[model samples]
Target: MHAFKRAVAPVLTFALALAIEPALAGSSETGSGGADRLVGGNGPDQIEALGGNDVVRSLAGEDRVNAGTGNDTVDGGADADSIDGGDGDDRLQGGPGNDRIVEERFGDDRIWGGEGDDLIKANRGNDQIWGGPGNDTIYGGPGKNVVDCGDGDDVLYYQRAGTARRSTGCERKVREDSTIQGRVCGQGGTDDADALRGTSSGDVCRAGGGNDDIEGAGGSDRMFGEDGNDRVFGRFGNDVMYGGTGDDELQGGRGADRIFGGEGADHLVGGYGRDRLVGGPGDDRLEPGWGEHGEIVDCGPGKDLAVIGPGDRTRGCEGVRRGG
Candidate 1:
């Protein structure tokens, strides 16, 4: 009986050791990560999360937060704030007037700027973003990217390649031989749209509500003039556009393109490259491209007269041709 008791003694001791360890290790341990909530009230503050999936939050003082490298969920609680993410997948966003959220190329990212002038960036990887209710400028480089401006005026700049043929002419490189090429035939391509649409310059550009002047600057793009007298400029690429309400101007520059002047007194101008032009509703003004090969004329639907000819690649309008 004594030998059997002795044999069981060690096991009992081990079990007791394990139980006491929880009591000792969990309390009175410095930086033990027991601090799940920290309130930095009304003073400039910083919260650093040591490697682990952590929830770190900062309250309404001018604050800076670093969710130290591991999968993290961070919030810039109220007031003006700035947030940074380090090594590991992170989700970070700001709240209230004027905030900035920046993410490095360590993971797939999503960022939001909640009201006021906000700056949000995914410096790397495929990123998704939204700028809420303010005038904003968004940019993406070398990755599959998407950005949406929920309300208010916004601007988006995408990557573009400029093609211009030049010569050391004593008379100068005639601004006449510049033409734009969109895509190579028979090659698989991606459907990338330019959000460079809608009117800016505080000139009421409601998505489908106010009279907005819209421009799709780069990439194969699309646009619709929802209301008011709107002007639409499609700077480059294979584009398709529509003018929905009020009098509108549609400029489809370079590429095999299509344009529609919907309702109101509308004007449509087809620029260089193969194009399809359609004037919809009202007394529509349909103009083919004018000027020398590389030059442009500021002819909106009004004041400037245009002549439409047989579709793309047709040398109908008076302009300098390449090598002419």
Candidate 2:
């Protein structure tokens, strides 16, 4: 009876320990309505910080965290994690790893997608989001939001115009218009990099300073990459693109397109249909557009390289490589 009592005592104590601290046994955690500071272990954790201004940290492993209500701060440290900051002004951080974060409720929240390729959504209120390092995809849902795509090629999606203000280093900007009708013009200033896309109706898009990305999505469009290293693409319809300064890449796509690489070492490629490519100044490389017929290639000044296609009229270019 004494031996049985000793064995049962250890069993009861272990069970009591697990009951007292369920998280230690890898169980989900739910916080009280008061302010609580919860930290998870190096394994996958599900933490629901319900109510009050809580601080939650899921250190390592892929974790799912919900910061419910009040002003909260949550950090999903390492690995791919999913975090949602529900209500109140909150600061959510996805540290390292390709994480998904959603601040889908009220208050002006601040979110950081640290390192890795992250997907972040800021819904409602004027929120600020940072896509730190790596290629990240961010969505600006309602309200005036500021998205900073830090380093790497990043894509930002926003519904409606003037809803999102993008910082430099953002490679793409996609306007999610519910209706299929295209947009008008997209313009950017000198301080930051800009990704400008045109509409179905003839539109004018201009970008200034920083590394800018411009695409003429439809209709006859005019695009200007004013400064810095730029990537300008005329995706559809008859488009005109100008790469103004710095090392630039310009492609004329679909319909009768015209592209000019202005200043610095530039690469100009023609797209389908009859197109014209002009390399203005610096050592430039000019290539013929796909299925190009009767296309014009002018390498204006500097030591230029050209790929001559059949039925291409080329001038101001040296060391021509003929296409087979």
Candidate 3:
């Protein structure tokens, strides 16, 4: 009876192992320290390819993929995923669903936040990021990088004093430099109408084409409304406003401000400080005495009008319609 029981136990153990083999086999994989390729099956997978140029494809389901220390390519396919490219020039594609992608320092990377609202944090390198068709948030690390927030209202946090060439469908924050200067849209074009707001430090904000609304929140600010009918608001501190082209509106909110309405019919309002309003080309309207101190209005060319509030001063502005 003891011999029969031992033989039966061995047979049962073999059968049990065969039964569980299909469920445990080939669902997940990992790579070694050499260049390798790891692919995940259609389940919540965890894949790690350590220390080599690797390719990791998370084919479906919620996946967490880590490509460790190599020039790797990681694609997070569908569903929510988290991918990290550790210490190499990597290309990360967050395909289809909302994903979190992290890039390690010391290599130029290309990241695509594809579909859904994704968060992409690029490490210290000259990176190129595309926030494709979703309200994504991107952090451009301490390198000269290019980010295209494709469609949707995306937010980009960029380096201080770093130059940004262009932005479409995005609200960008230009981190304050050592000089406490924040510059945005200063040397580029915009595809859509942008609403630009500045920080407490001195800022230079530029609006390129498209009907834009720009506000200088605090500190001494400089605003340029280049092309398109725009509204420039200087909220605080001594400010300078330039309405480059198209019918535009300029408001000097506080502090001593200088306002320029360049080309096209414009409306200039000096809000609450000693201000200078200049109307350059085309029919324009300049308002004064909307501030604590008296304002000076210069009607540069074309049929321009000066609207005077109480206690306002004007020069070269006459025979034009006047109002409060």
Candidate 1 regions with alpha-carbon error over 4 angstroms: 1-39, 159-324
Q: Which order, best to worst by lDDT?
A: 2, 3, 1
| Tens-digit per-residue lDDT, 166-185, candidate 2 | 44458988775433222235
How do the residues 1-324 of candidate 1 rate in per-residue lDDT, one tens digit apiece?
223223332432342232211221111211124323333444456666656665555555546666655665565656556677665666565656455566744766555666644545455555555656654434443345555544655544333121011101111111111122222212212222112232222122123544444555446666666665665666446677777777776766545567777777776666544566655556665654421233222223323333533332322223322211
**lDDT for position 34 in model 1:** 36
> Rank order by TM-score, top first?
2, 3, 1
Q: What TM-score should be assigned to candidate 3? A: 0.47
Q: Candidate 3's residue-wise lDDT over 126-184, tens digit each? A: 87777787767676777777677777767676763442553345665544222222235
Off by over 4 Å in 3: 1-27, 174-324
**What do the candidate models score in CA lDDT, each in turn?**
0.49, 0.75, 0.71
TM-scores of the candidates in the order shown: 0.38, 0.48, 0.47
Determine which window of 10 residues in candidate 3 has minimal summed lDDT. 17-26
Identify the candidate with maximal lDDT: 2
Candidate 2 wrongly placed segments (more than 4 Å):
1-27, 163-166, 178-324
- With a 3 Å backbone cut-off (N, CA, C), the pairs that clash in candidate 1 are 198-214, 199-213, 211-227
